[model samples]
Target chain A: MGNCYTFKIKNNFPELELLCAEINEIARESNFSEQLLFSLNVCLEEMLTNIIKYGYDDNRPHDIEIRLEIDNEIMILTIIDDGHAFNPLEADAPDMKSDLQHRQLGGIGIFLTCKMADKLSYERKDNKNFLKILLAPHVAAL
Target chain B: MKLTQLESTDRITNLLLSGSLDISGVKDVEMDFARLASGKRAVVVDFSGVTFIASLGMRMLLSAAKKLDSEGGRLILHSVPPLVETALETAGLTMVLPVVKDAPDAISLSQLQR
Candidate 1:
């Protein structure tokens, strides 16, 4: 079994970068590719930004916990935050082919996260939102 | 994010953007574009100061630029740093948008009908 790491951070955007940077370092230590690291960063940013924006009411601070587990060349990221129960997958997706004049921009973050991650799941348990994302190593070229 | 603008003689609006382009700053970019859209002028977004861009930020800029493009208006970008330029190019946006070297060059090139 691979080792697991946990981190707790305030629900702030700048602080989110620190979390992402840590993930990147772990990916490096685990020998994951650069592409996988970037994908993780992107997914984490999307999920965290959602919580920081809509999870808390007014200026109340919240705790966001991130867990990293390695399993058979896969990196699993589990993010838990005590914010409002909002499902990011439920958000509407933008039509990428739509003309600029008619295009809407708010929903692309979730869309990108969904596309980039190999596996993604979300749960709202005990008044907390848990989002899990997994990234697998790139298949070696033939 | 910090956004500063310069208006050229040919009525091209050059906006210099810096800092992280993420969900937190997307709203400000949208509002700024909406304010600029009210007028009939070309727009150029300078990415010299930008270091990182998220999907939301890219969508915001693309949506705004498309709006301007539809009304016989022009929108160009310039001075994109290496990392951002690589991402934009890889995403195939470089082909769709004209990018110049500097703010002055973007304004000068804006004169050429696209």
Candidate 2:
């Protein structure tokens, strides 16, 4: 058993900065390494940004929920948004091999989130999108 | 976020960037970065001060790199911290943009492409 933390923010782009600051404080208190911290930050920012940008069709405010739980050496992150039915796992991976001339920028965020997290799962229930991510400390090569 | 434009000479413009290159950070310097990078033969960005980077920031750099590439110029980055460097590498940006050890090396790499 470990500690769990939950944070809620409005579906606004500017709110991301505040959320990131809170996460940073928590990461420091938990003694998270810089690499792990950076990975978590990237994953959260990409997911929330997508929700705020394209989740809603109406111009109304909404609440996005983020929950973090740390058990043993692994961390679990859950994000819940009352947005449209979009599954990130199904998103196409960016063509990383493509040169600059042909590369597309739109898909890199989701691609990065998929690549950085050790495990990712997505579900939609009652018009809410749920995304779960698991991260583990990197073990150096022997 | 802070962006300092070093004095340009020898056809290579140097820009020192520090702080998180997230959405707000990118908003703070994208226009200025564009202005400084425009029409330059080569640009060397010092990434030692950059603490974190997101996809939006990557887009900004990629857009600038592509612009420079189209103009027959090059963009070189150096002194990146390991975490940020990993993010760039994961995105496969090291293929398009050259990452070196230091500013001098970055400048020399950009110069050689000319």
Candidate 3:
């Protein structure tokens, strides 16, 4: 059986620190290498930041759920949010060739998250956005 | 996260940053970072103590680099940990933001640009 951990936070941006701390603790206990931990941290922060920043249109508070299941060398991360129905996989990739003068800032978050993870899938159900990410051991080796 | 501003010369401004540069870490230093980068000839950020970095942190650096570039200044990063360097490389930011080996190298690189 795999180990499972879940974290729930408000839509507020400040809550990201808490989420990161929890993940860090779990990753350490699981003996994750620094590189793997960094990738996982980046993926979590990027996805959660996107949801918190652009997922909602109102000021009302909402809950975001993150679940992690670790089995052997594979990790499955599931993030569920009650915000807008947005599929990150469908977002346009950033122009990597742009020079410093023309380079865009914000779009790189989702791109980096996608590149670091092994598999990414998105689904919208009952007005909630579900994002599933898989990180295999081989991807972490990079 | 802690941000310490080193001595500023006529051509280069040094900022030593230590800690996680995630969302909160970026927030703690974004304003100060911007304030220091503004109108400066060159900026060297010593990343020896930075343990982690994320997209938010990368965005902060990129924004600062773009701002410096537009103002005829440059931003250089040195002493970056392997993990942080990999993250920057993965995002292809190393092409724009120059990452060097040490503080002296960063200073020299910035000076050469001027």
Candidate 4:
């Protein structure tokens, strides 16, 4: 048995603030560690920001659905969007060895999200982009 | 987000940032932060109060740092929460923007001959 929460947000940036606020509350109530909270926020912010920034082709607004589930010791975050079939897993990893002057911040969002979240998988089906991220605690809580 | 700056010396500028540097937080302070960092002095940011950061925050910091770098100045962050520091490190930002233990360590590093 587990708990699941769903959120529907517009394909815009401002909506994320409300979404994160509610998420932070539930995550704290569920005993998510501070580290876990940070990681969750990073993943949400980065992924959704990417989708909002580059996911659409037309000027009209769109809808993005987010599902957060807590199953025992694991946290699963699933984002479903109706944007183009872009797979974040295949996005180019940014150059981590470059000097400051040579560095470009383009690809770091998804790359850092991948590093923070324990597991990530992406798929395109039924004309929707499904991106799932799994987060496990670094240490079992007492 | 809240940004506070200390009385700066001729060689050092100290700023303390509090709250999440997420989307809205970045919007709340990016302009002020950029203006404060646009100096030739070493800019040391106290990051102990920041509870969250994402790539947008990173971009804000990077733009300011890049601008400061072009002007021969630098940005240093200290007292970062562990996981936040890890996120920065994962993106290889801590190299260009050094994260030290405390304000003193950051200050000392800023004093070192470049």
Q: List the residue pairs that clash in candidate 2.
A: none
* Chain A TM-score across all models, in listed order: 0.88, 0.90, 0.93, 0.93
lDDT of 3 by residue, A1-142 (tens): 9899888999877687788888888888887667667778878999998888899989999999999998777788899999988999999877677888787766788888888788899999989999998888565532
Q: List model 2 lDDT by residue over A53-139, tens digit each.
A: 999988899999999997666778899999889999999878788888777677789988988888889999988999998888654
Off by over 4 Å in 4: A138-142
Report the poorest 10 consecutive residues by lDDT, candidate 3 chain B.
B105-114
Worst ten-residue run, lDDT, model 2 chain B?
Answer: B105-114
Candidate achieving higher lDDT, 1 or 2: 2
Worst 10 residues of 4 chain B by lDDT: B89-98
Q: What is the per-residue lDDT of model 4 for residues A1-142, given as tens digits with 9 covering 90 to 100?
A: 7899999999887787889888889888898778778889889998998889899999789999999998767789999999999999999988777788877888999998888889888889999999999888763422
TM-score, candidate number 2: 0.93
Instruction: Score candidate 1 by TM-score against the native.
Output: 0.65
lDDT of 4 by residue, B1-114 (tens): 999998789889999999999889999999999999987879999999998888899999988888888988899999998878988888889888888999889989999987
TM-score preference between candidates 3 and 4, better one: 4
Query: After superposing the true interface residues, what Cα RMSD does each candidate give?
Result: 3.7, 1.1, 1.2, 1.0
Q: For candidate 1, lDDT tens digit of each residue in B1-114?
A: 778866544576767788767555565566876666434567878788886666666766676677677777767788887756755554445555677788778777877766
- Report the lDDT of model 1 for residue A46: 75
Of the pair 1 and 3, which is ahead by TM-score? 3
DockQ, all models: 0.27, 0.77, 0.74, 0.82
Q: After superposition, how far is residue B34 of candidate 4 from its true place, in Å?
A: 0.2
The candidate scoring highest on lDDT is: 4
Task: Work out the iRMS of candidate 2.
Answer: 1.1
